[model samples]
Target: MKLTYGITDKLFVWFFIIVLIFFGTILVFYIDLQHIVKISANIVNKNNEISAASKKMIENLLSMEENEKKYRLLGKDDYLNYFDTARKDFEGQLKKIVQMEARGMAISDNWKNLYESYLNISPRLRDLKKAQPSKIPWIPVNVINEWIEKIYIARAENEYEVYLATTELNRRGQTSARNGLIGIGVSSMVGLLGIIFLAYTTLRPLRELLKGIRSISQDRFSEPIRIRSKDEFGELAGAFNEMSVRLKEEEQMRSDFVSMLSHEIRTPLTSIGESVNMIAEEVMGPVNDRQRKFLEIASSEIGRIGNLLNHLMQVSRLASSAIKIRPLSIGTSAFVSECIHGMAPAAEAKRIKIEAEIPPGIPNMMADPEHLKQVFINLLGNAVKFSPTKSKVKVLIEEDEAGTDLMFSISDKGPGIQEEEQSLIFNKYYQARRIRGHMDGVGLGLYISKHIVEAHGGTLWVESKIGQGSTFGFSLPTAGK
Candidate 1:
């Protein structure tokens, strides 16, 4: 069994993937930031505590030195007591510094040895001072000064360590920021690619469906839409294909019926036309003026029916691709003149002037003479039929700009076709809305003429605007000189 993945399913999957990538990047960054913060905080806090303890030790050593100086000058027991007290306070601060060094502070070995020697000498120095009342040794005082200098050095080193820790923290912060920007950029690129993929998948099938609909509208029922997906559009395409097949079958049935009907009616109409023509010509007996007039009307009506039947037969033959053309080379000027002369009677009834612009030295075209004449007659007849009285109908023939084809155009001063309907005018049985009730044709003239032109490797087109008159034109390849 094949899995049917719809557009909704695809959208959900892509959304989930994008969300996962975004959050995964954020989580990794959070872990890295926490690690950096922990390490930096430990280093900075330890260095700050060591710095504070070293400052207190320096003050205690200075007091010890001051009290010893008083004992040597005045020789008092109270001064000795003050010296002992300051010594003990200094010992307490030294112990604290040792403890911090064991944890992580980087105190120098020289500083530690100096601290131990000062502790060992301080008690003996006090006793000797009591024993000898007037004399005091200068050696223990010098040792105390050296210890004070060591404390200052340790404090400066601790402050420097603090600065180094702060700098490391800032560097880590910048690195995290850069990594975050890279992560965001990657996520956005992935999201944009996902959006483009989704749009292409969705719109491709819709475009194919639209194209198929347009083809069907133009009477093409054989082209099927091919969408290779297990989605709603696929189902719709299957149904559309079925509908096209049914429409093609129905169209064939209709064409066959029209062809059969036209054939059955044409034989009787031909016989009746002959009988009416004979009566109008008075071949059977002499007739009065009134009788002759009625006979003439009957003859004309019969002839019109015959022409209508002939048109129906021609349309059927064209549809079946059974109309074969015999190509011949004809003089361009003379042939166009003959068509114009044939249409002159109809134009005269409306007092419309028919003008021709056949430039000298126009080349002859390769086309079926009979079928080509029919095309010209159909075009000219439409012009004469639609033009108002005293209006001018113009015919122009010339070589196209490429110098390889002949272009013929018929222009009429009639109510023109609308722009929207111009493309649809050549379709079978498609009558212009404005001329539907007023026009006499069943809209087959242009349709048949278009096919006839196309059979000879040519194209027919119209240019028109509402109330501005219409020009119908066609191009035919010329016979090479």
Candidate 2:
């Protein structure tokens, strides 16, 4: 029900489509070229033929004048006949020049005017010669010469016009060819880039999907799908990633439940076992000095059981979202120092020197003081428990921009946690098994601290080096209305 394509396939499709457009454009230009060339050639040929006819008309008109002069001087009929023949030839050519003007073939306005003037005078002069030959014997010859001069002027104008038309036609033809070539070039480049872009968009998701599959095979389900697209492939990747996360969460919850249950049952049963052993040994049988000691040890073990149960209950309540937080203004620096001091007895027993470095003018934070105190006390207590004898435990406070907030850092000079275990440190009941026998409490201090800090709109995390020491820090919001 879904369609997906790789980058190369997408690119190929785009390129193929572009090729179609390019070829279509080339065909269009080819047809345009053919039409332009045909029209241009026709215009040039027509102009050249008109020029030739105009030049022949001028020659014939001059010849007619020469013959008329000879006939007038000698009174010869043969010369008169020659003059008539040349005259008829000139008139026929002149008519053709007029027709060229009517057809819109590069004829000038001045040329048309001159031709009109010659046509009007020629007929009138011929009639005058026939009626008054004795008084104006050479009138026809004079009119012929005048007409020839006018015809020459008109022909010259027409020739110049034709030359201009020819030049312009060539210029326009060249421009059209150049534009067509440029269009072809630009379209081809655009299509190529479009293909490349389409291809990259298609292929990147497939690569990401493959990499995700490999990571899943290695039992790593934390990497979420990062591909952002509107296609079916993107939707599939997102769905698969969501499923992976849900499964991982379910599996982790199952493991945590089993481990916590075992620990809960074992702790109480151990306390009851120890108490029953003390009674069976007859240590408290007579209810004397040894009896008192046995009762004391049993009481202490019972208290330990109660503490363990309380911690388990706290984790369950926090995980199930049963706790509600009420925020109030409290001095951050003072509170942090007090929590550190409260753990002084434990540090003193380990011979660890505890110190607080609270700066002046620290901001007050908005949070539940009791919850924040529990967070700080748990961190400080862990520092005291793990620090080597005579080693120093330091607490530092500072603030910065982005909002008024408090940063409390507790550092301990003890064997630091391994890098591989750092990420799981805040997970519920995730104790470092290697150091479990050396400590007296379950590994819920940091987990509970993380929950409380987050509930107060803060963050908690740890930084450590294997050989040097470990630092636990948290951020709390500044005081506000």
Candidate 3:
């Protein structure tokens, strides 16, 4: 069978398990305490019973002795026999009292000491009856009376002691029960609060994550994920934010690629259509050698579109592995000089002067050489296109305490980019709206150069102002020793 459960459900299940274990242990402690309380009550009751039996035995002995004296004074045989029978009965009761006193001894030490004193003095009173002295000193009777009095006093004392002990034990038991109940009550409240907090805290993030996932499923990459948590949920939110940024970039790239494709294809189609119209109207009269030049130019424009498409496809492949740096030590000055030399022909054609400044002690960089070269070439090419006739394009290289870097400043005397468009300049298909002159190629050159520079652990940014000039610069990291 297949089973499914949500994350919150699982958390609740574990929470219940923990609570169950905690309460179960408390319940066991409560049961054990109850048993102790019951044992204490039984001990107090047994001691009270021993005290009552001792009182009864003392009363019987006193009644039997009075009967013996009355029968002797009257000289009645039947009364004497009754006294003898009562004496025997009293002796059996005394033994019973002694056994009961022994039982009281087990309950508490005070009861045991009192019981032993009573047992020792009671035997002396029994000897007084056997002696039959002429003067009958009455001291024996007084002593017996004194022993009985003491036994009664001890019994009363024992009863009082047991009563006090029972009161305290009961009080202690009640206090223990109250405290345990209070503990359970407090623990229950705290557990309830903890469960509520756990549920609400976890559910909030889960709801946000669910909403974000649903929005992403609908291709809404622009929506921001709103999750604020300090735990793993915060990490998940960060991951989602990164994913949204990547998707947004991909959508922008797809849109730009489609727009560029239409523009490239239509430019060639328009020229081809114009050429066909001229040939059909006999405007060139059977297409002479000079007339064929127009056809050649139109065909070449179509071929140029094909070449641009091919180069763009290659560039797209290279951009797939964007920001994957392959670091290697490369001479800074030599690399910059080579880039300038390679693009010198184009610079010369535009009548743009090139200035190279490569200091003797400039260090190398750990970077992708080919990507760095592409970045310099793109910057130089832009300078060549925008610079006025006889204007200079400067390439400077220098090293500092921070790092060794080469700055290629391509300043143009032409009307520069607007302040607002500077940020969007690196964006694909985001051409400067204020750029007046017609420029060839889509705005992918600077964008591609920006990605390449960043991949080599560098930064690309333009310092430009309208109608003044634009100087684009990039920096790279120096190779570590």
Kindly report which residue stretches of model 3 are placed more than 4 angstroms away from their true locations once superposed. Answer: 1-45, 73-141, 217-219, 222-239, 266-481
- Find the candidate with the highest TM-score and give its number: 1
Of 2 and 3, the candidate ranking higher by TM-score: 2
Q: Tell me model 3's lDDT, rounded to 2 decimals.
A: 0.67
Q: If scored against the real structure, what TM-score would every candidate get?
A: 0.80, 0.52, 0.44
Estimate every model's Cα lDDT from 0 to 1: 0.82, 0.73, 0.67
Q: lDDT for model 1, on a 0 to 1 scale?
A: 0.82
The per-residue C-alpha lDDT of model 1 at residue 426 equals 84
lDDT of 2: 0.73
Best-first order by TM-score: 1, 2, 3
Off by over 4 Å in 1: 48-175, 282-295
Candidate 1, residue 176: Cα displacement in angstroms equals 3.2
In candidate 2, where is summed lDDT lowest over 10 consecutive residues?
Answer: 128-137
Q: Write the per-residue lDDT of candidate 1 for residues 1-481, one digit (tens) a residue.
A: 9899788898888888878877877887897789788767666566666677677777777777887778778878787777767767777767876766777656766568866886677666556545666554433666767887777777777777778777877877887887788778877887888889878878898898888887766544558888878778788889888988888788788888888998899888888888877877789988889998998888888877778878888988987889898878888899999999998889999999999999999998889999999999999999898888899999999897888899999999899998888878887788999988977888888989999999999999999877879999999988873
Candidate 3, TM-score vs. the true structure?
Answer: 0.44
Clashing pairs for model 3 are: none
- The positional error of residue 453 in candidate 3, measured at the CA in angstroms, is 40
